[model samples]
Target: MTSPATSDSAFTNNSCDTEKIHILDLFAGPGGLDVAAHFLGLESTGIEWDANACETRYSAGLQTIHADVRTMRTERFDELPDNINVLAGGPPCQTFSVAGNGAGRRALTEVKSFIKRLVAREESSETIDEELSALGDPRTALVLEPLRWVMAAIENGKPYKAIILEQVPAVLPVWNVYREVLESGDLPGGVKYRTECRVLHTEEYGVPQTRRRAVLIARLAEHGHASMPDKTHKAFTRPKAETAPTGMATLDEAILKEAEHVERPRANRKEREPWVSMSEALRESSKKLGRSEPYVVVSNYGSGGDPKNRGRRTSDQPAFTVTGKISRNVVETPDGQPLPRFTIPESGILQTFPSNFPWRGRDQAQQVGNAVPPRFGAHLLAAALGLEEGRVAEAIEKMDGWPQISEEERERLRKIGCGDKGKCPTKPPHPQG
Candidate 1:
């Protein structure tokens, strides 16, 4: 496929303009950040090679270039429009994820070395490419792709005004290296960015899942602060069973003391809301499915890989991290009566995608698992663009449904056999205990 830069029609078709913030999302899987950008009233074009994700993007009417990021040369930026001022992406995180083999984690040292080399211009691109290939898994090298694009943009004399990147928490060290390089003032242009990198809890940002991501935000030094957004919800604490008071303490007295301690923080509680619970987040799903009883989710995998020690959570708590194996999880009433596992829409909802967010193509579970939650992305986008808090709230409200696609666009996607009708199985293929 041709690079989006050469295909000026991509920008023109999307109505990209200089008046508003426009984002170019790299490795933009299935329009997660694009959904947030759309709701926030920003234009974005995502570059992705995965056919599965491209199908979904087309169905959702998201601006997309179905090409690999690695193939898009740095020189392509010379042809890109001036309106695409922001850069945002969440690179593939499999090798770096805690649940996956630790290839990326093991290669962290080598990756950092590569960053230093790139910043100092100590090695040619060909040499660095050979070194990166030597790393065990090819995906491990992708963590540094964003840095390459950033340097390329600067060299092209069109540095982005703001940049946002996120991945599994294990990638924080990589982002720290990015922060160092961006702020080092050694780029082709003397462009400097005020940067911050930190691990953010999704539940702290109102996502109904307890996912943690390492995020980096950088803004041109001429721009104001580039801080992470303030948390808008209280952090989730796992529920613990109550035990009878020991020794001289009576049960009532102990209960009273515990209540007082909890109440003490109430005076300042107005600053943030309670962490969103699974029941509250999935309320609409439950009602639509005609399930009135409370339920518990029994994880498919064990807590830390022990088959006998499966994890369990009630509807009152935020969901455990949603993963590709989400269909393997068992949902049941509190009394142990089996209920259906979450459908595709429900799974997307847990990840903060709209319930009707048109999910299509293969490995739909993986798509949901890999996406940067739209709610979380909105906050990141707002902070990077220096937008006010109200913008985030407004954007979130718009996420209740997917964006409406025009009839002409729908026909265009339909001709390519991509439409709003999602083909992925909603229910699991077979029953599981």
Candidate 2:
């Protein structure tokens, strides 16, 4: 029998996790994080606010809860698994993204504190204290929500021993706030003031897309340790290229060499529409093309009534941040002319979703808007884990030689030959008959 999308993927069966870890993915969409975590052998419970996202996760055998993290605490839960060692989530980052006018940065004050308190409560639980939780709290890094939550969780003792938060580069100021907060010792947890923050571009880290995010990593064991997962992939170069070399990765290189781009059969597919090419975007905006183009423009004036026309889009530039809101996906028509809405898959690919992956939301916009780029998130998490980021097949090529022993077999041998083996040595006595 053929396996479902949930059932079989060679890459998933052998992700970098290589061990077991527990994860709580808050605001996790379609369980992309869950899928990656599961690949790393981490058990996950995905909590997503969107019903469509919940269904997508459900197809993967995840215990996907459809509820907003912002409202989850107010609502009571019947039962839940024990203390989570790892807590993870990407908060809905609408009001605080860099793409918008530098407004809504205030989302931190409005909602971040509640999330902090939630983390505090979860950490205090006897159930949770027993295990490690890798949680990405606050979703957005606005006002250092993740750091603040970590501070709360530790509460003078160590709660989250390891924490990693991802955000847009524009949020560096907030990270500075994290430094200030932890240093001030104004919150809970034993976290010290000094932490580590770095810029991690997904493209540089083996993800096929051109996404750069600010990553914060902290090692609580030290007097003060805040660190992030380091980069693994490098830029694609000329001459003879090396695989897994600490170099740059190119869009064409990663996509063609690594990502399995979908090629829908022309006969069965809808007639494809050709849009302005990259070169077209590089040209100057047309003076004649005002907001009058309805199908092509996303302006409020003239015919540009569509909400997608709020901003200028060009092929040469990376797209604006892809938010949970689909209304942001519109673009002005080429030639400054009016045009139809961006195709769901088109907008989705712009956000870095693999072409072959399918989305499940009711509308094309909903599906494209709700999803996190699996390839990007996968690469980021892999980098965070301090392991290589590549598909199983790609990874295989990098290894000097394949191990003769299977992982399961090696694990069994390890149990018998390593852990507690010395305490109680066992052997078959010499049988001399």
Candidate 1 runs further than 4 Å off: 1-18, 74-80, 239-270, 411-433
Off by over 4 Å in 2: 1-18, 74-78, 98-102, 106-158, 180-194, 206-210, 222-226, 229-358, 363-367, 388-433
Instruction: Residues 1-433, candidate 1: write the lDDT tens digits.
Output: 2123223222222122334577999988888899999898888888776678877888898877655576554424543457777899987887877666667777888988898897888779768866775777667777778888888888777788789999877777788889888988987777788788877889999999888788899877666557787789999875432121122124224323322311123233347899998889989988998765588988766653456667788888888888888888899999999998898899899999998888889999988888889999999988787676777899999888897677688557544332243432233211101
Error of 2 at 247 (Å): 35
lDDT by residue (2-58, candidate 2, tens digit) is 122123211222222334345556667765566555444556676555556544444
Candidate 2, overall lDDT?
0.42
Clash count list over all predictions: 0, 45
lDDT at position 35, candidate 1: 93
Worst 10 residues of 1 by lDDT: 424-433
Model 2: how far residue 377 lies from native, Å: 2.2
